[model samples]
Target: MGSSSLSRWLRPEVYPLFAAVGVAVGICGFQLVRNICINPEVRVNKEARAAGILENFTEGERYAEHSLRKFVRNRSPEIMPSINGYFTDPK
Candidate 1:
């Protein structure tokens, strides 16, 4: 079909649908980049403060749930051997 015929056949409402989809996709991409780039450092500093016992804790475990895990994951490039020692050695 020619371009004119295809344009005529498509409904006008389709343009709004396409625009909405584009907006949603843009938002999802922005969040993905922010999480990959930004959230890790924020989480690490907050957790590291607590890890240093500079922050208070409630009547529970010293480390917050997932704090240590996220810290290790974010810093593993520099601290992998020391972190691995936690698993490799019993005491």
Candidate 2:
């Protein structure tokens, strides 16, 4: 009974499902951490918000923008930036 149950749980066909679940969980965890720690619009103080924190920021402008966006904005998009820069740089 133990072997049968273990074999059923360890089937090769179930690996994809496990991979998908793991990817989904990783994405959820990343988003949760980002929202809690870095998202500017998540105000913890109701009073401060009411008083004037980010009052001038428009709704569209309030969302936290990833620093990567700014870094890539002026540069041409590349699949591997470090490698591209390494080869292209003058010695």
TM-score of each: 0.35, 0.52
- Give the least accurate 10-residue stretch of model 2, judged by summed lDDT: 56-65
lDDT of 2 by residue, 61-84 (tens): 545345676777898778998998
Task: Give the candidate number with the greatest TM-score.
Answer: 2
Q: What is the lDDT of residue 51 in candidate 1?
A: 59
- lDDT of each model, Cα atoms only? 0.63, 0.76
User: What would the per-residue lDDT of candidate 1 be over residues 1-91, giving only the tens digit for each residue?
Assistant: 6998888757787888888889999999987785655443334455554655333444123333446566677564654788788889898
In terms of TM-score, how similar is model 1 to the real structure? 0.35
Candidate 2 Cα lDDT to native: 0.76
Check candidate 1 and list the clashing pairs. Answer: none
- Cα RMSD (Å) per model? 15.3, 6.1
